[model samples]
Target chain A: MLEWIRFIFTAAFLAAGIFILIASVRGVYKFDYALNRMHAAAMGDTLGIFFVLIGLVFSAPDIWLGAKLVLIIVFLWIASPVGSHLIARLEVNTNPIWEKDVTAARRTIEEGDTHGHL
Target chain B: MSKRNSNWGNTLQGRFLRWMRFGWEPMDVLLIDKMSQDRDESVNDALSAAENLRDLQLSEKYNADTAIEHSIMQELDEWSLSKGRKIVNRLYALLSVTLCVTVILLLLETVIAMPMRGVAVSPTNNEVSQRYIEEGMEETGAVNIVAGMILDYRAFDTLGESTVLFIAACAVLILLRIDRDKDGRPTQELIAAEEDDRSHEPKSDRILQGSAMILTPVVLLFGIYVVLNGHLSPGGGFSGGAIIGAGLILYLNAFGFAKASRFFSYKTFALITLLSLSFYALAKAYSFYCGANGLPSGIPLGTPGSILSSGLILPLNICVGMVVACTMYIFYAMFRKGGI
Candidate 1:
């Protein structure tokens, strides 16, 4: 029963990993802008790795292995978000879409404020 | 035409007629050919002039003068380097800097390595132990031995660590803090701009905002738990502080910098930092004067397995946690919108 549980957990994690990889590729191809692609990649990095870690925890043979797995999960959790934020900041600074037309209603409000204040 | 050519060719006249048709002949035919050749030469000259004018126009349009000037400057630079006294000065400067750097580096390496050479490990409770015995386990009802050690055993260190955090916060604030002219008071213009920007954003994205809202509480609770139980577990000041910092980062990322700033202001942060540092220093001083001639008397190491076992670890942990959380948030805020 334990072996079956481990096998199922492994399969599920592998499937999730594959799914995230596909989604990341699709997102890269489909996204209109670099920022949008980055968002997709960040999501894949955090969620995909999380699923894989959970699977590792379940598959580990002993408590020590499980604890070590948890350490990896923790380390990744801390590092991943910071890495994503840095990348996003770099992208925004270097390749800002200044000429692109704003579609969000918030932009109109901002424009109104700028003109009205002056 | 054949009869006329045959009669003419019988003598010089015939030879001249044949030469006039195919080669240079000295007579009226040669003069006519020379005039045509002069006209053709003038036409070719006109075409060449037109080509030169076209090239000049292109060069003017593209600002080729600037390119030529740049190349000329580069060549002059090469010439100067090859023939001038500046090269010798530069070489001397390079040699001096290299020697200075090598000497400085060697001195630094020796200084840094001196402490590690043939060192003796002496067990002295430098502030940490003193605080642990005096304030940590006794004051805070925490069990884990290490936690007790952190919270009570070295409460002062926790305080100093927190002060370090407070200093970091102040540094970040000073570094990133933008000067604003609000109502003639020096305020951050960037903060005003950020505020204006945030106000323009819509509040209708319930799904996105709601998840962040939910996560904030959960993460905060976990952070507090880590801080509270620091004396009893592996997680202490640094870890708890980092966790709280992470929580703040998450909140800021989801809700934006302006909203996060509302919860903590520069004045409040400054006050907290000052208070934490003073509290830590005062506590240490009190312990030093009241205790055995500034020497730490080991606290009664209580039942080893109990929550209150390590005397001062718990309080120290709390202090460290607070300072770490505040510093981390300050750093994040400064990095995000406040000019770093």
Candidate 2:
């Protein structure tokens, strides 16, 4: 019964992770700008990876392997956001049209229109 | 632009052609073009003076000679560079494809003739491989069989690999490192490099700095852990050194070269690489000599699975890690800023 429960949890988590990854890829195709794509990829880097790895750990052969997966999760979570932040900075600093897009987004935010652009 | 123009404007290739009109990455595709303005002007002036001199005398022989040379050059360009080059390229591609197909067919034939799987009398299950698998732990005292093979039985080959990395780092250093003269005035290249640096790194970033502060130590520590546990676990010198080098690069990116130079410079890189490489060679020499002479070396291959086991493998792992880490950092520094 416990094995069945664990299997169900693993399947659910894996499905969610796969869905997020697919969404992230779709977002990369849908988004028009680099920052938005970075936002999409960062979602996969954090939450999608978290869910998949956690699902794997749920059915790991050994506790050590599970702990290693957890370590990978921790390390990636710590490392990936920094990389996304750096790439975002590069886009903002390098792209000439970034200023206009950013200011327009800020103006929208001021008018109580919430966008996840920033 | 490519030579072919079969597609009009609808395809991805056409789109690529349209969008690829910008300058090269970093906008410095022609370095000497920008560096020798005075020389170019001087050459132009000298050519014009010679032309004026020729015009004053009106040398028919010189005019005829230049015209003949120009016509020859144009003919050569038309033949080799414009029209005939495409035929040469197609012939070369045909030869390459024939060779590739022959090789693929030969390999496929060999594969078809190979024995079936799950058989007891397989080619791979030899006495030599069996000895390595069974007695490897007892002989090398490494829980990881691959690490034992690489660092013990094949130590000299790994030594050569590390030496190759060191030499490559030296090449990069010679190619990219910007040096100052006795007077310490920056060269034209150094000034240009500084300008490039300014454009890339306009300011010290706070977010990067904070994250680096939190992550550098952890990364470095993990790298050390990996190097130390090479004989016991999966990771070894090359991977661990890469991690350490990555951590160093992150720290460098956050704090800038000013802080990195305080602890690490060209001299430091030289010293560490030199010391590590020489130590590895000398240690390997000692072990090899002992094994050849049928004598036990004084160093003990401690119990397997321990961090301090595997005789000289631990120190050798550390040496390789140092060399790799330094190589990685130096490559980053030289390429990024043309310094250190």
Candidate 3:
């Protein structure tokens, strides 16, 4: 029964890992901007590696090794988001996106009037 | 406007067109023909100037003739102003780097060379050792080996180490602490407010958030375990402190800054840091007093392989760990909040 439980847990972790990887790839292809792409990359790094490392920790032979693995997971958890945020900020500052014909939308929202061109 | 248009049409095609339309009236012909010729000459001069500019831009690698002229002018300017400031600056930087490397190499060589020598230099063989041993046994009543060395034999060194840690904690806190009222205008606040107005909003992933929620607790527990078992194992103050700091960072990431800040407030962190350093200092001072005068020390080093073995190592480790963890978290928070 214990062996079976371990096997099922391992399989679940593996599936999660694969799912995250696939989502990251799809997100990269689907996103149009650097900010969106950064989201995908951050997700891939933190969640994708978390699943894999957690699985390995459970399967490892000793407590010391598992503890070291946990350290790596913790480091990534702290670093990945901050790194992605900085990169996205840099991209936004360097190459900003211009709004297209949003004056009518703004006017309608502000004055409760909708006569201008959309 | 007419002159500008004429200049635009001054290439070979424009001259060809002018030649084709040569059968107009005398006044028209003079105006058109003379203007076209002048335009053509001006266009050719502009093209040559543009080419020269491009050559100057690329002259660094291609070794263009104009590059020599530029270098000559630059050299003359350098000679006028003290003759060798640039060279002196370059040589100064080079010398400093070389000196640093040489010093590091010499220190490493000394350390490596000591072990290679067959001389057995024991700390206990010196004159200080006899006095220390007599005092340690009289005060601490511990006889194993390293414990006696740390607690009674070289208590002064241990005291200095703790004092160093306390100073480090104070320095980090002072450097990282934010006081916008005192400073008048904080640069970080300005940058953050500007960034907040921009198009890009902060992004987060729900899936990662979910996983972090589960992992964070486990990491925290392991960190505490490392700190708790520091005396028994090879791990001690520095490693255990780093582990706990990592756990704090994990919590910070799992929950956003607002939530993490709820548990780890600036006031609470500052108080804890002050209290921990005070505790370490008090412990060391008590040991120092006992060793200086003729007083019996209460702290005992249990059997070597036992869990509660080290005389004061465990308590010292815990104090160091707390100071390190608090300072690290404070630094991280300051950086995250753009206090720098």
Interface RMSD of each: 10.3, 3.3, 8.3
Q: Write the per-residue lDDT of candidate 2 for residues B116-222, one digit (tens) a residue.
A: 77676888776888988999998899999989999998999999999999999999988888888669998888888878887687256676887788889999999
* lDDT of candidate 1 over B7-59, digit per residue (tens): 44446776576677788564655576577677777787898999999999998
DockQ category of candidate 2? acceptable
Instruction: Give the Cα error of residue A36 in candidate 2, in Å.
Output: 2.9
Candidate 1 lDDT: 0.67
lDDT (tens digit, per residue) of candidate 1 on A14-115:
689778867987898899887798888877787887787878888888989989788777656655665666566445434537323333433665778543
Report the C-alpha displacement of residue B167, candidate 2, in angstroms: 0.6
Which residue ranges in model 2 land beyond 4 Å of their true spot? A30-32, A62-64, A99-118, B1-110, B113-122
| Residue A102 lDDT (model 2) | 64
The candidate, 1 or 2, that scores higher on DockQ is: 2
| Candidate maximizing lDDT | 2
Cα lDDT for residue B18, candidate 1 = 66
Off by over 4 Å in 1: A1-43, A60-101, A104-118, B1-160, B179-208, B256-262, B287-309
Pairs of residues at least 3 apart in sequence or in different chains that clash in candidate 3: none
lDDT per residue for candidate 3 within B13-94, as digits (tens), equals 5656766787544456558678767787778889899999988878755766678879998888878577577788889999
Worst 10 residues of 1 chain B by lDDT: B199-208
Tell me, per candidate, how large a share of the native contacts it keeps: 0.00, 0.36, 0.00
